[model samples]
Target chain A: MGEFDLITRYFQRPAKRSPLGVGDDCALLAPAPGMQLAVSCDMLVEGRHFLSTVDPARLGHKALAVNLSDLAACGAKPLAFTLALAMPGVDESWLEGFSRGLFALADEHGCELVGGDTTRGPLNICITVFGEVPAGAALLRSGAHAGDDIWVSGTLGDARLALEAFRGTLELPADVFAQARMRMEQPAPRVALGQALRGTASSAVDVSDGLVGDLGHILASSKVGATLDADAATGVIAAAASCGLGTEILRTCALSGGDDYELVFTAPPAARAAVEQAGKESATRVTRIGRIDAEAGLRIVDASGAPISQRFGSFDHFV
Target chain B: MGEFDLITRYFQRPAKRSPLGVGDDCALLAPAPGMQLAVSCDMLVEGRHFLSTVDPARLGHKALAVNLSDLAACGAKPLAFTLALAMPGVDESWLEGFSRGLFALADEHGCELVGGDTTRGPLNICITVFGEVPAGAALLRSGAHAGDDIWVSGTLGDARLALEAFRGTLELPADVFAQARMRMEQPAPRVALGQALRGTASSAVDVSDGLVGDLGHILASSKVGATLDADAATGVIAAAASCGLGTEILRTCALSGGDDYELVFTAPPAARAAVEQAGKESATRVTRIGRIDAEAGLRIVDASGAPISQRFGSFDHFV
Candidate 1:
């Protein structure tokens, strides 16, 4: 029999009124009254995402958190999540730590650790998070429109730098290493700011793969382009510089490097004031770094409107 | 610095809620007024779950169906599901088939494939399904009580037999081979039976790992014990024997086999009439085989009510 036949025999059953259940361009979920649904998932591997020597508790937490960031990105409040944990052994300590980390995050986020599966194989962790946005109000990547200013909520590249430090590739002073490693170890999700942007911002996505990569998703999905101000784009480097690091290196890390977990979004020019207002209230900086363009590709320009040459590219999982 | 820390830095977000959101034991959603939520997840691995030579479409479909079976097991109405797919390459045809298979099931079940992830790896899939159960009506594994009857829906051991055939340990006529392969390739989820059992059964679970192993979970969770009639347990073997299989081999296969995708449930004494009525209306066989016990461990009894010498075990991922 054909694959579809097989899947149908096993998957299809009685259903409620979901317009597209299990098969469609995308599944649409309408949240309950006064509640928004949170959504998140993470991709993990043996060598690339983790090492065999790493603690399991932390691994569990990290796996759950990656998905949590997606909820943060959508500005949906976190609720519950399922974990898909693949491993070669039944390592108790690892499971204990992983569950600890996962539940710790769940506790903090007011979410629950519900369903999951444990299969045998190389270590791969994939977690899907569920959150809620008010009915008909979840933020999407396609809401970005031309003339909307692009903004990112936090410092980037610190995670990548920490990765370097962990790998022993880039040397760091004690203080810088501590801070950078902290950024890499425990990323602070911008859930508060994301909630604030729900009605105010037009398009949004979490910075997962890298700034350029996630931003490109918004651009392509929205059928718009962007021109980043290199100065603002490299503000992360400036912060690194103030901490006695090379701006160019940190800029490269911020641009092309990933694991940032920040929210990069677009708000209409009219909403820029609201963003500023939100920044003041949240005590978190939301920098306007670029503007959506009528054109269909991305470009980087200086304040003077001159294009800036950069070597950064999107994160390619296959490549 | 470590992998887990690295992951958490990017993932944890704040939980906001209606009923089930992000940080709970499970995500809850009321897609429609008074409708229950469907829940399921699929886990895929590279070498174990699928062979590189297998059609990607089939792989994807199988991935989706496995989780849908979980929802079917729960007797909840299907709604939507999320997928986590990991691959080493991006093959358009593979993705096309995978999507086709997935969508076909979704369409048939009125479920929408709401969200998913694509990333680089050794190829693993994890899908979590969402469905709904009327308030206070979700079927569980712990509802079986003393004097309640044990039941299983559909044929069993076909998937395990198919696996054997795949490994070339078993030889069959081409038609039988095809049938066995069909059993493996596409399993019929007992959605109708599960739903029918919701109001009538005391406890239930979809048979995945193996009857014994999966049933162990029910017993453990329900904090109850069971005494299976070995003769009735071997009834499937007798059925196969009439179809030309040897009794002993068929018995072993039925006992230790996994991947049947059938629902194994317990009906309370008071619900027996309801169970038979529901089964008749649903056109699904509900076998009566055993009874729940006050004891705290599973027991296998012969036709004369004496303990059998045969050991009971099922598939374990680790052991």
Candidate 2:
């Protein structure tokens, strides 16, 4: 079949949420009245963002999920998206699996597949997501205050642990490995949690490149500092005890591991109750792990309140 | 430098036109109060959409220009765009040239670069563009009627001639080759022509594929057929005479060659004056090549009024 026919067969669907869909030159979208459009683009390349042997269905889900994480961080409701894909050649089975995974998540979020282009080349998937948020309501990394409580939703470091196991640097029980691999392959973006914490959270970011590194973005953008509680941070590492990991290894992964896709946010102490309520409403666990500070750099402190000088680096594509 | 730093240094600029730009998780766009947002995406891969030896600046321009052509076909005015780029390594000089070409056209069209991702991989460029048009004013391919006149903007076939020479299938004089090569390397998207024809043309499509193939899309969408004038079509080949091409060769290239980025539109006979006025307002030449018909399939007739049955196929990547 031709390239266009392939797209029509696998990717094109009736766009219920968008004004116009795949058949047209351009898809049309009308934002809710008095709302602003939130747009973000993310590209995934084979052997870099994903493994060559990765399942097509999971890869597709992760591709769109990564872009949706950006929108969730902005507290925007999912609306519509366009995918631009390049592949080495046509593989009908691969396309079928990929589209099924993609549409499943898209349907869950009510995000319509609006328009896109497909061509032959090395495998690459680029997705641009569009959503809407009331003016001035989007949670940004620059809104943190000096005294706000730092919080994180869900868990952290399991994806990184899974990667380590895959690379043969570590080993775990079969059940633990499977669970960790699932976290690595298919991240669930916390859209509802972001929308719930819109007014309550002072500043927010999604943890894509480890907890400390992603949180550093907020600190840099807001021109503030933070003091991460060592014990509290370790408590957020899911499955560490079950996996029989050492404390040092657990701390290293929790602090420096990337691809968690959890929300890290800050709110004033007075809004603590509201933040917790919001988390409960979204069915995501909220953990208070630190506090924003007036100082200029991030510091990790032990139970005795002594500063720890461990370095935690985030994922950098160019590095 | 890290990937984020590279983006900030090379791609980021003061986004005066957009509500929010690069630093945020999602760029914020607020379309004109009564206008609808039009979105289109196009992807370019190394050794596929372009030659590896091509100038980086031209490649950047073409990547965005192709997507803009889609917006133009929908009669949408440029607003903003997001770029997702992947590369094998960090090359400072390459990035400089690319961003320069990209921004030059963006500045001319007032389309702001808002938000995107940059990752390390094989070279790939994908751009998603956003535009705006008044409600119900877009020129759609399904709007053509059986009695409408078909018109094309700008000359055709030069780009195809360039490709043929590059592929060693044809030879031309240096000057003719240079002119044809320019057409293939840098196609000017018919943004103005499309915007001007919003209310005048019955249906419109940008000529990325061959004229016959792209025009067939309009026919299929509108459930109509067409009769192309062979002599009139040959006259639209801009540099064929200078290149010493035969009539048969001229006809083949003009009708079946792609990458024109021109506009092929149809309007009723009564709207002929309006269509001509649009072409004048847009400062683009318009040529009448055929007429839409009540018949079920396309037909081409020579000056002697004899039907030509030879086949002309358009470029299809998968085929």
Candidate 3:
């Protein structure tokens, strides 16, 4: 089939909220008055972002979910998104499974597929998502203050543990591997927690990279450093129980594990109860594992406040 | 350099019109109160969309130009765009040239680069553009009338000529080849003309996949057909003068050329003068090439009104 036929069969839908949707040269969107449009784009490539052997359905889910994580970090309600997909050739079952996964997540969030482009080439999925946040209400990485408490929503390190197991660097029990693999394939974006923390949280960012590396972005933007309690951070890894790993493994994975679509945020110490309430309301686990500091660089500390000497580098595409 | 550092050095910039620019989870934009947002996306894959030997700077220009053409077809004023690019590896000179070409066009239209993604993968560039049009004023492909005059802005076929020459299917003199290659590399988008024809035109579409195929989209959307004046269409290909091509070659290339990023539109016969005035104001050449009809499919006829029998298929990625 041709590109248009492929689009019509898989992606086209009636526009309900926006003025126009698929089939038009350009989809039309009008943000509600007093609302600012939050836009973000993400591209996923085989072997780099996902394994070639991954399920097509999960791949689609992960592609859109990653973009949605950015919207959640900005505390923006989902509106619409454009998908640009490049593939090797036509695969009916792959397209069906992929669209099913993509639309399931989209429908859950009320995000419409507005417009997109499909081409034949090496597999690449790029999504540019749009969301709406009220004027002056968006939570940005620059909003954190030195005295704010750093918190992370949901669990981390499971995705990285799965990667390690998959790479044969570490091994897990069969059942444990399956659970970790699920975490890697399908990350639950902390959208509700982020929306709930809007006015209560001082700053926010979704952790796709390692906690320390992603947190460094907030520090650089907000001009403040952080002190992460290594023990407290390690305690949040849910996979630690089933994996029979050492404390060092747990700490390293939890602290520097990328691919965790959890929110790492900060709020003033006085609003700790409010942050806890937001987490409770969103049905997400909130863990306090760090604090913003006036210092210039990150500092990792044990329970007794002593420094750790080993350095766990985060994932970087190029170095 | 790492991905973050690459972004910082090349794509990061402070927000002037947007509430938030690069250093955040999402870039925030607030469209004017009465304007509706127009969104479109296009993906360019290496080997499929362009030649490997093409200039990197021109490749950047062509990528954004094609996307902007979609906005132009919708009669939307340029606002902003996001680029998601994947490359095999970092090449400083390539990035520098690409950025230079991209920013030159972006600055011309006041379309700021708000956010994007970069990764290590097979080269691909996906751009999602945002434009704005006053409510109820944007042109659409579904608005054509049975008796409307079909028009084309600027010349066609030169880009196809350049392609055929490069493929060794045809040949041209050195000067002629160079000129045609420029058309192939950097076909100008009819942005100003589209904005100018906002109210005067009945329906519009940018011709990327040849005149007949792109016009087919208008016909299908409007539930109308058209009789294209093949002679007039062939008369508009400027490359004919130096290419030493016959009538058959000119007609085929002009009607089925896929890379010419020009506008094909329709207007009522009474608005012929107004269409010319719009073209004049926008500094573009306008040609009346066909007429919409009540029939069910496209018809091509010579100057003598005899129907043409040859078939010229348009480009399709999956076919």
Candidate achieving the largest TM-score: 3
List candidate 2 stretches off by more than 4 Å: none
For every prediction, compared with the true complex, DockQ reads 0.17, 0.87, 0.91
* TM-scores for the candidates: 0.84, 0.98, 0.99
Between prediction 1 and prediction 3, the one with superior TM-score is 3
Model 2 Cα lDDT, one tens digit per residue, B1-319: 8888899998899979787778878999998888999999999988878889889888878888898899899999999999999999999999999998899888889999999989999999999999999978888889989889999999899989988888899898888888888888788899999999988899999988898899989999899999988778778877676667887778888888888888999999999899999999999989999999999799988877689876788878788
The lDDT per prediction is 0.68, 0.89, 0.91
Model 1: per-residue lDDT, tens digit, A221-308?
6899998876686685422555665656766777767877788999988888999886666676788899999998889776688876
lDDT of 2 by residue, A208-267 (tens): 888998999999999999999876877877756577788777777888788888999999
Candidate 2 residue A298 C-alpha distance from true site, Å: 1.1
* Window of ten residues with lowest summed lDDT in model 2 chain A: A234-243
Q: Please tell me how candidate 1 rates in CAPRI terms.
A: incorrect
Measured over the true interface residues after superposition, the C-alpha RMSD of each candidate is 9.6, 0.8, 0.7
Regions of model 3 farther than 4 Å from truth: none
lDDT accuracy of residue A44 in candidate 2: 91
RMSD of each: 8.4, 1.3, 1.0
Error of 2 at A305 (Å): 2.8
